[model samples]
Target: MITGSDFYHVMTAMVPLYVAMFLAYGSVKWWKIFTPDQCSGINRFVALFAVPLLSFHFISTNDPYAMNFHFIAADTLQKIIILVALAFWSNLTRRGSLDWTITLFSLSTLPNTLVMGIPLLKGMYGDASGTLMVQIVVLQCIIWYTLMLFMFEYRGAKLLISENRGGDMVMNNGHEGGGAGEKAAAAADGKAKIMPPTSVMTRLILIMVWRKLIRNPNTYSSLIGLIWSLVSFRWHVTMPAIIAKSISILSDAGLGMAMFSLGLFMALQPRIIACGKSTAAFAMGVRFFVGPAVMAAASIVVGLRGTLLHIAIVQAALPQGIVPFVFAKEYNVHPDILSTGVIFGMLIALPFTLVYYILLGL
Candidate 1:
């Protein structure tokens, strides 16, 4: 059971973030301090600068050599299960699409492990559980988040290619036809002439995605941090104070800025539940219920038992990660849903997580 001290610790870690969020919210909704353009700029800075540095700081500082393979395997398997399910849904179902897949994947698999999981799980499970949580955070920063970025870029590239191809078809048809019948014939011919083979188009999209991923700072931040971790751990070297301090300056603000950005997003929207009540409720269901259930199955499959298994499921029940919302807003893909997820997810995470803790403890 979580004691009063544990609750205090969690609140200490969380309350300041809420304070930052409400400040930003009041600035926009009540004070009218920041313009729409200014909010965009603030979000851009958080995404490009603070988030990358924060990722690097977490990745580089962790003791990479002390990995728990069982826990890591459980985490990896759960994500793989979610991915395969998403793939099936997208390929075989009429209701599925790339956008929903991306958003749902984020909603179901990624939790606010960095902000909420560490402190809260540490309170519930003990100090050893905190180490496990950090390992999860490091893996998230290195592998899963990078994969999410690639998917976002891939979807963007695919859409851009389709739009360009459609534009070319229109131009070709317009130039070659003088009447309705002729235009229909010309359009069919133009589509045949302009549209590349599916395999070829897929290759082109992959290339474009790679280029965009390369340009993204988050991509390099994780890679460089991992490389630094390997070298530092093997050689017993430490980052110099100046360099460390510089990173800490921005990295320290990452979660706060992310929350502030979330507040700004909420204030600008028509309502706090930006995606409507039904969708927000569905999102909460995925965040709290579906995530933990899937994680429980994955943990059992990976042979996790007792406290570790409980920790796995409970951590999965944590709030929606704020970073994914940042990515959604930046990429313009279902930002409303994501923003709603983060805002309401945080609000209800405590009671839901408490229930999980009591049940798992039983």
Candidate 2:
């Protein structure tokens, strides 16, 4: 059970982040220290530099050989369940969309594991639970984040193709309807110029997504870190102090910078609930209820029981992750909703997580 001292430790971990966020918020909303462009630039820096290093640092330092396969399996299973459901909804339903698939996936599956999970779960479930949390972080950075980036790139490419096709149709229609013979000839030419096959177009989009993923630092940072972890563990090699210090300098600032970016985003918005009430409420439902419910089912399916199962469910109920919010703002995809998720998710996470802890302990 979480004691008063445990809660204090959780507070110690969280308070600094809130301080960074509020300082950024005050700078933007009250003092007007940064212009909109500057805020974007700061967020871009966090996305490109701080976050990648943070991912690398966490991944490289972990003892990959010591991973708990059962816990990892449970985590992977939960994400797969959500992904399959979202895929079906996107393909079959009129109300479903690619945008929501990406956003909802981030909202439901990706909790603030780095900032919130380690300290809180450690306090509740002992130091061993911290290892489980780190394993989740490594998996998240290496696989799921990369997949998220691919989805974003694919969606962007499809939108561009759609717009270009629309423009071409407009241009073709601009040609006046001339004589009957001329019109007949034009229609014949149009019919003869067939579009590429679906498979070919899909291959092209996949190629595009691959190229973008290659360029993304987050992609390689995690990969390189994983490779390093493997090499170091096998050979008993240690990273040099100088190199470690260089990485730690920036990576140590990562969570704080991310929170600052979130505050800047919130300050620039017209209100705290920037995505409005209904959307914010829906996001909360997914983050708290839907995410944990799915995770519980997955844990049971994967044969987790007792404290391990409880830890899995409680971690899922932590909060919305800040990294996804940063990506959303950088990609210009539903930033408002993500921002709301991060901001308000943090505000309510403590109580909600405690409630889960209590219920699961019972």
Q: Give the whole-model CA lDDT for all candidates, comma-separated.
A: 0.81, 0.82
Instruction: Write model 1 residue lDDT over 1-362, tens digit each, in one string.
Output: 65677667666656777788789999999999999999999989997998788778877877789888999999999999999999999989999999999999999999988777876887777778878887898888767877887788778757855665533433333333222223222345455524433554455445545665687787788889888988999899989999999999999888788779878877887777889999999999988999899999999998999999999999999999987887898889999999889888877888898889878876
Q: Please, what's the RMSD in Å of model 2? A: 6.0
Clashes of each: 0, 0
- Indicate the worst ten consecutive residues by lDDT in candidate 1: 176-185
lDDT winner? 2
lDDT of 1 at 20: 84
Score residue 163 of candidate 1 by CA lDDT: 69
In candidate 1, stretches whose alpha carbon ends up further than 4 angstroms from where it belongs are 153-191, 330-332
Q: Per-residue lDDT for 251-355 in model 2, tens only?
A: 999878877887897788777788999999999999999999999999999899998999999999988998788679778889899989988998788889888
Taking all chains together, each candidate's TM-score versus the true structure is 0.84, 0.85
